[model samples]
Target chain A: MTVAPMLSVSGLAVDYQLSSGALFRKHRSLNAVADVSFDIAPGETLGLVGESGSGKTTVGRAVLRRISAAKGTIVFDGEDITRLKGERLRRLRSRMQIVLQDPYTSLNPRMTVADIIAEPLIVHGLASSAEETRVVVAELLERVGLPRDAADRYPHSFSGGQRQRIGIARALALKPSLIVADEPVSALDVSVRAQVVNLMQDLQRDLDISYLFIAHDLAIVRHISHRVAIMYAGRIVEIAPRAAIYNRPIHPYTEALLSAVPIANPKLQRVRRRIVHPGEAVDIANPPSGCRFHPRCPLATERCRNEAPHLLRKAAEHFAACWNRDA
Target chain B: MTSPLLEIDNLHVCFDTRAGTVQALRGVSLSLAPGETLGIVGESGSGKSVTAQAVMGLIDVPGRISEGEVRWQGRPLAGRNADRDARPVWGKEITMVFQNPMTSLNPLMTVGSQISEVIELHLGLSRPAARRRAAELLSSVGISGAERRLDQYPHEFSGGMRQRVMIAMGIACEPKLLIADEPTTALDVTIQAQILELMAELQEKMGLAIVLITHDLGIVAGLCHRVAVMYAGQIVETGLVDAIFENPLHPYTQGLIRSTPGLDAEEERLTAIEGAPPGLLQPPAGCSFLPRCPIGDKGCEAPQAMRIFETGMVACRKAGVPAWSEAL
Candidate 1:
């Protein structure tokens, strides 16, 4: 018997208001994330991959309660957090944290490593005296592979990799069961990216933490995630085990995404059929009906033009929102 | 052979820092074929961008192309030396798309006018023709309702949209060669795929040779025909994409592949390259990657200049190119 998932986002939606069209015009809502749903098992890493406007980051922020959800329920630890408010909401935030994409900007330049890490502890009232906070901060820093002396230095003093380590330290300060890592390594140098990703993996293994690892990087996500979720036009189209997703992706979008990723093997690289990418802006504010991706999908069919497929379970554990899963 | 689109022979770039002259690119050599996509792969400061800058003749001062030659279409480019503060190669035979769109684009200028400027300046088209060309370019890059978007500012567009505009600007006049510096590094995965596909398609349609600079090996694997792996401002590994991927002779190339997350194996522990990538100022003796060479010991003590194998090349003393039998 399997236990209920730790976090479930169902029919999640978000829309931001635009400027008035005329003197007494009705406000138009721009749908950023539309009816998106997925689940994260306990201690599982759910890799969310999508384009810039696909609203993957928005889903993460909504789950963390940093952004308001216009619709749907975010159930965490078996509790509905969609309408959760006041102290309960504040308490929920402590249980969930965010590690931002730009480590350099996410950290305050004026704040020392010790202060940055301790701020979360002090905010949550997890530590009492200043001495206790210092000890906790130092421990967190060391946990991310930083020397104890790194505690006193400001964020600017650290390299991009080092700054990310500080960000990880801060994220782990709350002992959060779920952490939203939004493009955590996109800003670091290539070689340095490995150091931080490895550190995060080690932390997750040791602490049994769950992660909503959001990134445009497929390879990195493939490295750390237990399962993968591919999103497009503010909705989820595919969800599967990491190996299943990488090796035998179900959805055409997933396949196209995988195909576009350059292989290190030259022979395969030369022979692989490229799913020629569509132009950048197809105006997703009002996405095409039926299949939002029909415009770019190589194997799109007439049935695709008139029918918007729902996310349905294809295998025992795999789920995909597409017409031809078996294809 | 018909003259390669672009050639760099014994290229060296250096910045006159207060500490000393920091050598960025050391004897970097590459030749591009017309309408081909050449992927330059390396870490940050690996001279990938430096190569692009030098080719565009946009190297900043006190940085200069201290030595070497950059030949374009069998002719040496006019400004062999970049001015300390001049946009020397703007809107000409070669164009560049920077990683960041908003910063590269003019916030105050309309998108149409920005692209039209390229056509007008480079191709010497009239204002009306330039505007029409801008609209066509915008439409080609997938910014629909191009007529309206032509008037839009960079801020009015999304990240992907702005990048589309950047692509439009780059190819407005149909440059013979396009240098894209980490074009999709700032984009999301799905969007990155889209942008990459678009670039590939555009390259085919326009028949333009492209210099795509990125650190992602996966990119070189898929999009690039030939790849040059740069380290310490030098081309450490140069070969066909398949050759380099299957048999990486350089330790740096090997370390990169091992670090990337993939489906090939379940890596319980990632084999990270040791120490930092040596600083350009000091670098390492013999091999630039000697400090972080995973397979290095005392055997790599001798200096080794780059050598070409059948389909690839490497700069390593102890290591020989992986034989065809070993690859399988």
Candidate 2:
């Protein structure tokens, strides 16, 4: 049929060892992400969303092999990338790139904008001559809303939003088939946020690039993503099309999260209920038996407390973890 | 009814800096009745935080409220009250939850002890009793393992947990009002929801009013009962939340709302308010927003002034800018 998806993950598990593997005593391990699986089709964007420490970042890092996966398979371009090491891993990194959250921190202050955008090309030998590199770098900077003259200026001179444009230009330097953007515009001012997001959407359309967009803001993710995945603790609590997740959430956590997002207009707030879960997030080191969300779940039952649930199909192409999905 | 809860009349806060006097808040007047959430919405440096700081009597030194009267519960506050040994009544009568909880909290102290200290000193609870109550308060704000977490340092908790701890500490003494200054700026969206829910629940249980100082319109839309739109150290528009949103009066308020793209909108291009906010060091002369005003009439050129209309208020020089209109 049509060639396999650009990026695919099955049974992906990422856990951090609190201590080393030396001691006789059993060291604790925090399961940052467990048994997570998703696919990013070519030219489509999948938004991964969760609160702080939800392990969404870990997933992005794992897919790029930045961190060692405890278990699972990562298939990129129909080849198993999970076991690739050294030279092979380095080669694969060019096709799948990352655009970090803070543009100020990601770009080297010492380097000029020209050098910053040309990094991936020079490293991967995509450009041979300085003149050829200059032409490519100029084109990228312009595409991301920066002027061609910006190539000579240092990162410090640019505003917060302009710096982010530089970061996007750098990510596209290698013409990466897939990109992992983690909170790309969250730190930016409200006025500039939209422009950057729109630019990204434009880049995706023109270049046929797929994105694994990870962020905390739903309103932002809703605009760009084809599918949305909500994370809790370290698991994908719900995953579905954008419309299904935002308008008709199946998981209680998802519902609460959707309700919690503040609307732009001040008037329609009465319809919003202040959902208060009077318990804390479960410890990742020793998550609750069965459902990790059981402690704070409003409709928790005996089965929910002890019987672990998986991604059960609640609707077409929609999956939820709740035992009582109907509820 | 009895002199309102806190009456801030003709308040003018300014800074006498090396450059010149920065007019932060200019002749701003607002009185809050107990159990009313007044949302002061504005962009950065709109003097929302300064107003909250003024209420707490914690305005930074060298920054003076050049003119105004601050009356708390019908008594003039000059660092004294009915009792002779009264502090500014800040942190006790009107506690505040700041934007970044990590910086606000004492990193050296345990979370539990820090919260307990407030209850012990203000509410006159015993150390043991205060610790017990602290655990309850922590649990009440959606913090898990409340007792165990009490002994943990601020760095040990996540961002959301840290904010919840600040809320617990702010409400420890049952302050009539809680000033949450951008409480969710550091948090992600889902955690922000949880925090808002917790804050609303606590307000209901404790019968506390909240003055939410934030730049996020979404929080203002979903939370505040009333809002005071601020610009260049002045309240340009003050009205009920619905009235303000449905019918924004001033050009600045309209610009902010238009700039934000709606979640459900099927549109492509978003309207952006061009240019940056004006520097307060040399405030704009005739109509601060005149440079960017889309509806600036001839009156805009001749010193912008506040106009009190029926629904709310507007500070525009436009002749026909109504307080409540679908024109926006």
Candidate 3:
């Protein structure tokens, strides 16, 4: 009787094969993302946050079916989309979209703003005629706060923030239920970045869209995300609601990452004790045994090195993978 | 009273392009005392980096320091032509760390040789002594396996480690002042934290006066003792770190603080500044922030001078003790 979440991904894994180069050479496999599982309800935003090489972007790409998942299922809107191919995958893709990080290169420079936005509609056969496509593009542009006149202009004429708006309009053209935005505002300037973040927040509220927001900037992530998942070395270390993750993170990696973020308030910044990870970052090709964070964890015990810990429910709607979470 | 360690008075920088003369820094000024950290906070094209480059005598080509005085230990090093090489002042007295380590570190040279080059040039030590000192400096910057890692080229090191090597080269001569322009901006938050902590530790031990130029106010809040908010190639506001963050007088400063999402405070909607920064091709005649100022009127039509308050200086016609705080 209960409706399923908008997107549910479980036990997802993505392994990249790096060729050693030469004849008769065995290929090496790198596990970019491993055993990541989360669900986003309708109109919800789930933030995937971690440092570089944390496999956060890999998780986002897997959910969009842009890259093949080595293992696990991606059930989107009650349909198993993991193995979908050809027409089935194309049809399913119309309901899910992606907005990339670099606004400068993401959009086709040759394509007009209207053509870029309407390309989806024409390809998907959502519109019958050119006039219908134009109407849709105009609406989408206006929805993303761009002037309707912008439909005729090229992407080069717009600023970085405006170009990002066009990208949003292109993503919105499909009117998808879910959007996978990877470091959407990281390339932007601080002032312009806030504009895009606010626009995304507004559009999410107006259109009732779900977002798989992947970013390394925790401040912007904290602003827009409803729930947050912390990934480290190809594994999800913790998942919790926004407040719980920010205020009371259980995982050692999450704790260090949060404490690492410098707040804008000098009064608070001066008095805070920063948790500096003493160990080197995890090597994804050869990750540490047991809990991946054990090497850098302040309270890591002997058991933490020998035995891997599963996601244990620490509180209501909070899960963390740590042996000595209490400590 | 002793003069400040470094004092920049009415600094103006311009680049002569084919299109037009780009006035990058217009009367920008700042002062740093010994062992004091001054953060220059601004968005892109706000001339934060140019100010640092000007200090290091690295400004080249069409770019010129039109006006201003850069005094090192109360000695003037400004008002000179672009070719004037202040070689003695550069490495031994003041060193700069740029944003991108990939570009800054020579890919052809090993990390050890790069550090040793600086030590040999500035300290005038023997090759072997410089090599030994390079390893010691690498270890000092918290790079593990420093002895072995030094032989590796820049490509072999990760972004964070390469930046650590860059820091080692920057402090190789025991410089009195270090200007780091967006040093950690390219790295991730965790790595950024590590690099920042290393810089802080180095600053304390060496008593290095740091001019930390960055777009992130959060980093400024955490690291700098004094802060300057730059807009349109000018310092819109300057004050102690606490005064600048707590009661920002200039509207541009207020807008920056408001636009930034607070890591601690969650809000439903972020208050984004309306317009983009003004183009430097034709710098604004009146107040540079006139177009974006929320409280601009007929009074802002004329040029506004820096108004000295009890705590700091703000270049605004209608500026006060952050009265807009409660209004927001």
**Candidate 1 steric clashes:** 4
Query: In model 2, how many backbone clashes occur?
Result: 1
Q: What fraction of the genuine interface contacts, i.e. the true contacts, does candidate 1 reproduce? A: 0.56
The residue-by-residue lDDT of candidate 3 on A125-190, one tens digit each, is 898988888888888988888888999999998889999999999899888999999999999888
DockQ, in order, for the candidates? 0.46, 0.42, 0.80
Model 3 segments more than 4 A misplaced? A1-3, B81-85, B321-328
Q: Which 10-residue window of candidate 3 chain A scores lowest in summed lDDT?
A: A318-327
Q: How well is candidate 1 docked (DockQ)?
A: 0.46
Q: Name the better of 2 and 3 by TM-score.
A: 3
For each of the candidates, the C-alpha root-mean-square deviation to the true structure, in angstroms, is 4.4, 4.4, 1.9
Tens-digit lDDT track of model 2 for B1-328: 5447877777888888898899998778887888888889887677898888888777766798788856777776532232223354778888999999989899999998999999988888999999999999999887778989989999999888899999999998889889999999888676787788788788788888899998888988877888898877888778888877887778778766765666677545555454455778888777777765666756777766668877776777662364223332
For model 2, residues A125-159, the per-residue Cα lDDT tens digits are 89999999999998998898788899999998787
Work out candidate 1's RMSD over C-alphas. Answer: 4.4
Q: lDDT ranking from best to worst?
A: 3, 2, 1
How many angstroms is residue A185 displaced in model 3 relative to the true structure, after the best TM-score fit? Answer: 1.2
Look at candidate 3 and give me any clashing residue pairs.
Answer: none
Worst 10 residues of 2 chain A by lDDT: A272-281
* C-alpha TM-scores of all predictions: 0.85, 0.84, 0.96
Interface RMSD (one decimal) of model 1: 2.1
Instruction: After the best TM-score superposition of candidate 3, give how far the Cα of residue B183 lies from its true spot, in angstroms.
Output: 0.9
